[model samples]
Target: MKIYSSIALSGVAALMATTAFAQGGTITINSFGGAYEEAHRQCVIDPFEAETGATVQIVTAYSADAFAQLRAQAQAPQFDVIHFSGGQEIVGAQEGLLDPIDPASLSNAADLYDFAKSNLEAGEGPAYSIAAIGMIYNTENAPEAPSSWTDILDEAYADHIVLTDISNGYGMLGFLMLNQVQGGSLDDIQPGLDAVSSLLENGAIIVSTSPEIQQEFAQNDAWVAPYASDYAFTLRNAGLPTAFVQGEEGTPASFITANLVAGRDNDELALKFIDMEISPEAQACFADALRYTPTNSKVELSEEVAADVVYGPDAVAGLLRFDPTVIEANRADWVDAWNRTIAQ
Candidate 1:
């Protein structure tokens, strides 16, 4: 809620050993905007700055847009650290755009779950948060709660489904999950495309933004959708008559990660910042505020918050994740295929 324009001089003085005080101990970071940004500001960034005497300037970007900026600034990276949704961090690692986080360097590394630590190769980043792609249905209008991804195609919900754009983080995830559900592999997404085409024919609405989906639900009688758990929480928190459910087949989650920029000058400070992010306090703040599944095994949540997120090792083991390297390489082709086969 509170955005710091500059770090306090005292804080800057404290961090002078590892990072020079420049522009008020400021460092740029890339992440998502809106409600998620607010949560990060309150939960992670604010506390990190308070403790370290640094200022984090958030530059909101996600998925494709985040990658585009990183690619464009390959020679002179603008962000000191970047947070990526899904496995984009893997792509960033492959392209030499990010710095590898040495587990030995982080004191909190031992506290993280095995899956979080094993997110990337030796030099890649680690997972900070987990959010699954699942189904959201308005309880007021839908006859029954959705139990699987296939429920979106049912005639009972005809002309009542709102879908996010495949180019977006969660949308692309939904696309891939549907592909797998219908017996299609990553390379052969035709089955997923065909399923979407059927949904389109049934009068499903393709929405490009979160606000659009909210509007559709408010005005178009859109009662259900396939989306990430975090956004579903956002909707429900805003007083929408909604509930989120992982598909019976399984939930596919995106592991949002923090990567140090390749050429950043403040490597030591950046690593310290990342360490604070995965700390139990920070992780709990996000889970309590936004229902984002924490990667830190030590983070504890209340029964209500725990009920919404994929909590504990057992819940996590049931979720699926795609190969970031594979998805990154074929993303453009898949997006084009989505447009050609369904978006049209």
Candidate 2:
């Protein structure tokens, strides 16, 4: 869900469509678990159940799991709606595991930004929320947030910076972003490897999990890390004095989408669920709870919440997206190189 070009969140806000009362039916949707599921329940499920009179069952699953399940159950699909945070929706749509949502059928479609609608042309679902990944710094130690991605390599932060391992999504994204800032690309990740090699040698703590990052910050005098915007809020909520900043160069976004599953008897209920997620109420609820930026143009964010996300058109314009095709093509070799050069 790359914003190929900037689309200003211009003009007056669109009126929110009324959530219609729906008939009784059961639909299943997969959710990214833990806080993502919690937020989903608050923002989408609770309201959707109330409005639609449908029993919505949520299975805890991530991108790969959702796609795998979809593929295995292509004939007798278990899911009616799917949530993807890692571009699985694109592949699922291509593989015919997911259905292309018709904007004409969903009333809230009119309020979405152009970028959100971009995937619809390719028969993929529109992004309902975006999670920005940027510099997550310990404010007490680094009172002034680092200005750029390269600042992670500055000697001033030696032994105090946390670098996620390439196996983890955030690590891969952070590395890709740094690779770009260092004049590298998917075809050439040498720059990032070289830079990160030095950081690892000079005492950068490398971890494979998000909780390890929290431990580093809490127990090891860690100062900064490259992580998602929501985790930064999670860190702050845990009583860590952390603040996030999109590097001057740019920041990467995790495009999370609500997709309709194909070959389902509960299509109406599924589309209703999708519409609820894209609505202002659901979008704003997710934002307030998880700091995920809204894709629906009509959702008005509070100033405080807006500060935590990629809020305005300028920020969205600068949102960097890694081509999943390129990434999937080269990831195995990249992982091998990471093991040989940087992971140790």
Candidate 3:
């Protein structure tokens, strides 16, 4: 059974107000590749193509690399819309590579969470969906759910913990949460650095990628790790005994945003694409398939998916988000500190 919010964007209001029928054209955007690329097709791309008659080209570039590509091609923009799974939209806006999104221009904008439109007032892209970064633990090894981020630090779970490197998005959020719980803000991350040192000293194992964490949990007997919520569902589906947590200190959110390229010739088409992305139907597709919590207030999810992700306004309200600009600014120093801590 499908349920949705009352304040609706009709087919006309949702897509385009100026045109009666969609005239066919080509638009381009970056892809995270592999399964995500396929999910993109299912959630937004194919439906968009069928309706608008637009050919959407895919550039296989993840967030940081995609931003680099945007900077390189700023003078002659190739991708009409850039999908920033990482929060590069903030940095991209500052560089003028991204056009500020006016929430008024999109019909569905009114139905988004306040945080979803927080950046819109500044002409930045709105987050279409969010995923939380929290604790992922093996039920077999740790039957009790952890109450706080510090639980991973306990010597009892020392060697069993999997520490993902901070360069990765999931790792970055996980580390940021650790740092925040340790009284480290984006400016003063030393406390977090100290915590990592103690964690390493206590015998935490370091892994660099998401898949690596899965391997540790499955074959290496990893008890717990700080990772994304959706991935915990992935682990559970992989036949591992696992569960996710939003630690008491707070949870960090990873936003998947769609942005407009500043000089792109297809503002109309691009806006339509962004509109479709935030549409209840498309957002529900992401929720069902990826466990991505919808940023659009109108989208509804089944009970199972809702339970796995941070859903609804109240839950989303408790989520923590560090400024993307700050993270982008201090990233180099943070990674260096992380490396230095692990080296000793």
> lDDT scores for all predictions?
0.80, 0.81, 0.83
lDDT score, candidate 3, position 117: 77
My TM-score estimates for the predictions, one after another, are 0.84, 0.91, 0.91
User: CA RMSD for every model?
Assistant: 4.3, 6.2, 3.5
lDDT of 1 by residue, 93-156 (tens): 8788987777877878899888787744454677788887888889899989989888887899
Worst 10 residues of 2 by lDDT: 4-13
Evaluated with lDDT, which candidate comes out highest? 3
Candidate 1 global CA lDDT score: 0.80
Residue 60 of model 1, lDDT score: 85
Q: Which stretches of candidate 3 lie over 4 Å from their true place?
A: 1-21
Candidate 2, 1-344: lDDT as tens digits? 11101111110111122233343478999998888888898777876665555688888989888888899999999999888878787788888877877788788998988877777645577788998889999999874689799899888998898989888877889999998888998889999989888998889878999899889888888998998888888888889988888998988877888888889988877887888788877888888999998888787788888878877777777777787667777889998998888636
Local lDDT at 156 for model 2: 90
Give the lDDT ranking, best first: 3, 2, 1
Which 10-residue window in model 1 sums to the lowest lDDT?
Answer: 1-10
Q: How far is 143's C-alpha from truth in model 2 (Å)?
A: 5.4
The regions of model 2 sitting more than 4 angstroms off are 1-21
